[model samples]
Target: KISAIANEYGLSVDLQTKVWQLTVGQQQRVEILKALYREVDILIMDEPTSVLTPQEVDQLFTTLRTLVDDGLTIIFITHKLDEVMQVSDRVTVLRKGKVVATILTTKTDKPSLARLMVGREVIFRLEKSRLERREKILEVNNLQALNDRGIPAIRGVSFDLFGGEILGVAGVSGNGQHELAEALTGLRKSTKGRVFLGKKDVTNSSAREMNDLNVAHIPAERIRIGVVPALSIRENLILKKYRHSPFSYGEFLDNKEIEENACRAISDYHIDAPSCETPVKLLSGGNIQKVVLARELSENPGLIVAVHPTYGLDIGATEQVRQVLLAQRERGAAT
Candidate 1:
């Protein structure tokens, strides 16, 4: 399996190295095989569905269903309510770093669990366009991109993202999805062809340059690209927005303004933290992702590059993330 993943990453490493080169999705698959190899009775998965696509997720669920039927104990730690409702017989909701609610999965809905966790009216679905949409927002033509290893990642891919569309790029691990996302958001330079934001050519724009153009990105690798673990939540929140916000008054930094923005994002995104002064690493995966999502989604950018936005999130969190993105799309943001 690692050798198979190596083919995707174009790495010459051994099976261990092959596993290292593969994406999170591929790694999950490898772990499953490893469990089988060792004849393990119990399988503990943390954010197991985070890196998988919808189809892959279904397949995994089916396999787990079979396993459960065969009397295997699978302990899954996640924040997704839908997954619990679907696959789990018993449900547990954790809040403030502790388990607050545990009950039968069949009796609990998203709202019930979410309200118990956060104490609020949780709308699982986003109101979206019931009408037609027009105009092309972003265009990619004959585009080619490479990963960090200087190997071809995206080869001759072309697509048009419309003015109000959530065009999900679904693929197995290492099918050029990450490279394509990087190219779209300017984290990586394209090897050939063009990328246009509306009609403006932005083929080789830098990350900073893309941000200047109201382009926001939800990076696939959250720990690597999204946040600095050591930084305070407030600091991380304003990391990208400081250059062009109330947080900056010309050449001076406005500490109060930064605090305000951070507070707003935290509250709105339901980030589970005691205060904005807390280090981002101290927060749970769901809360950390919420902070990142809030920062980008609240920006109301003209273009949002959401790569694996719901990765590492549970069903309820996944629904919220999807709702936020859908709401933005309905408001005519070219995502």
Candidate 2:
């Protein structure tokens, strides 16, 4: 019966598959199937398309439309105005725990909805400088790596990124994008080929070595790999530079300098926290991402390897992250 339903909805996922093995889109499909399997009258999706690829998003929208046609009610909740415009028949604008408006999708536009939700005009487009490709910053030649299951993930991937360039690795979640990023950042070992930082062959170098080369990485799993959640924001901000002169003096940490550094980062990155002493785990996802960005991009590293940088951030946070990356590119950093 489940197979039949899955077939009907174009959901071909294996019921026996482990959650860890599934892609972000497949995980979302599983969640949708779980709800549908119960024969529910109404479905409420909160940011269902947050981590899906472009293809997965279109497939999901098709499936949702089909379900709606078959008399199922779906409440799709997301901060993305574009998604709302595409998939919703009606959109409800809520601000400060109150509904400002609930109108038909055709009756309004993204700009109108943005104004209603935020009480101000939101700019969706950004002004980017002309592209001027510079010297090669990162060169991956025939790189190969494995995933956690001891299976081949990144298979002989080769790419060259120049300074002031943003090379996007686009594929579904289960693909080797994760492993490739890890191999480049030295979080995963490559069985073959070499990675070059300019003329330096730095393949299979440790994360510390990569750091020494000034290779900044904003990991996909931000909570797990990006920041130490139990640590205070101040400590997390200085996680990379703690052993340096300003943060440390021989064997002891200079608390005053560290606090000042944290304060500066908090203000610069617009991190919303009661204080720098606040634990990172207590802050919102967007703020946590900001902390990660603050730490990674603070030094203006040569190569910025960001995997799903704005994965779970809200609209405003998402735009902020994109702008930051663009700003980095403008300064001749390769992303």
Candidate 3:
């Protein structure tokens, strides 16, 4: 979050370096330092604990409490009910761009605060379950890929994605998971070995070819590569299938068909756009990702390559995405 603000202010130090090398508390401190270094008077942080552990969150709250005592105004943007109750002094609940309520935190608890935040009664918990086992759906054989600097990003990594399992790739960031996802999605070409998808060799396939073969991709950096910023939401929705049949009529352009398709995608994805013609650049981060996921998952693809799928999304929206993926997996889709 600080990285975005620092980029806005044109701070020169490397954000990647800070994220790669620092501890959780140290990383949060770097964000504070980046704000201070850039001479930012108003610090805005959004959903800060999405990546942090419990102990690290406590340390960060301590730091934030100290900073608040020092008279620094932090516009902490968060949807985590417990965090709001614990850290905030005064809470301002905004529902659909309007401030619904603003009250002292001392008088409120998590449930009361969440009710104000959403303007409805909300459940703030999850019910756990054990999943059933199934057959292996994907296999990676000695796959290798290079980073932009020509260094080996993923070194001989092999794994199997089962039909009815949510196999987690657990690690710190930049530990080759991003590259692995890219390689699997055919966005990043592999240099060695092959990727087998149910008896087919897809190692050297392009993203378009992979999509044709039922490979869907949700990129990690959606703002950079997922959507065209200058295009309208409707235009961006049909990007993957514009040149194909039904969306296109021989050589002549089908603007009406394109509009219909885009509207369908927007409605199916539940994109909160005022109109289909609105530019995607105006949507929030979660909404933008919703568009990408909608386009990718609509085809009921055989393989889904999700890179940080829940990043920057609210709990409800994240759960929605998770349910979609799980439903796909249950229907024999591989990840």
Candidate 4:
């Protein structure tokens, strides 16, 4: 029955596969199958494409269309204007808890919808001009690293990132991208070869050492490595510099300075939070990403190592993050 319902909704999965082993898209299909098994008339999916790739997102939309045709209504909740415009017939814009507008998708556009959601006109893209490539700011030679399972993930990798160049490492998930980023940022130990930040050899250095050298890292797993969920927004903002001056003095944290800095970052980054004292976990995924970006980029580091920086962000937040990264590069930071 489950298999029949899954097929009916254009969802197909190997019955023998465990849920843990399934891809994010497959897990979504399983969820839909479960709902169908219960004979639900309506399905509500919140940020359904948060963890999916572009191809998976398209597949999800197709499946949703099939379900809709079969008389199963789907209420798709997302902050991405493009997805809403592409997938939905009638659009409902919600700001805070109130409905701002309810109109046909064809009648509205990306810019108009963005204004309704944010209450301001937003730039969707940052204009990036070609820069003259400078000398290598960071170099990794024959690097090797092991995963948590003690299996080698990164092996014999070499790269050079020049000043004013945005080097993007593209690959599917679990393809050693995380390991490479971790190794570069000193979060994981490299078993072989070297990493040089400018003239300094920084291989196998501690994360603190990297920080001292002005190497900013926006980790892949935001909740685990980017920010502490239990900590207040103010505390998380100073996670790396809590022991430094202004934020800290004579082994004591300056609460006043920290709070003020947090407030400034919240405003500068357009982070939608009620208070700086709120726990970071209380905020939505997009807002949490904003907090991480605000803290890392505001430091004005020499080398910025960002892994999946725009992973789960909405269209507006993603554009903001990309702009910030480009701005960092324009400021002569090797990203």
**Which prediction has the highest lDDT against the true structure?**
2
Note the residue pairs that clash in candidate 4: none
Clashes in each model (backbone N, CA, C under 3 Å)?
5, 0, 0, 0
Ranking according to lDDT, highest score first: 2, 4, 1, 3
Tens-digit lDDT track of model 4 for 1-335: 98777666566787777776454455767787788788889999887776566776787788888879989889999888889999999999887779999999999999999999878888886799999998789999999999765778898999999999998887544568778988988889999989999999999999999988889998756887899999999999998889898998997999999999999999999989889999999998878998998888777988999987886776677878898899998899999
Which one wins on TM-score? 2
Q: Which residue pairs in candidate 1 collide?
A: 79-314, 80-314, 80-315, 81-315, 81-316
Worst 10 residues of 4 by lDDT: 20-29
After superposition, candidate 2 runs with Cα above 4 Å error = 96-98
State model 3's lDDT.
0.74
Candidate 1 Cα deviation (angstroms), residue 106: 7.1
The residue-by-residue lDDT of candidate 2 on 213-244, one tens digit each, is 99999987788889999999999988888988
TM-score of 3: 0.80
Descending-TM-score candidate ranking: 2, 4, 1, 3
Q: Give the TM-score of candidate 1.
A: 0.81
lDDT against true structure, model 4 = 0.85
TM-score of 2: 0.92
Per-model TM-score, in order, reads 0.81, 0.92, 0.80, 0.83
Question: Which residue pairs in candidate 3 collide?
Answer: none
lDDT of 3 by residue, 1-335 (tens): 56664454332245566364433333555666666667566778877765554665676677677667768888888867778878888898887789988989898887676667655666555443556666666889999998655678889988777665666776654457777887887788889978888777778788888878878888766787789988998788777877887778888768898788778877877788898898889998778988898778877887788877876776556656777787877677777
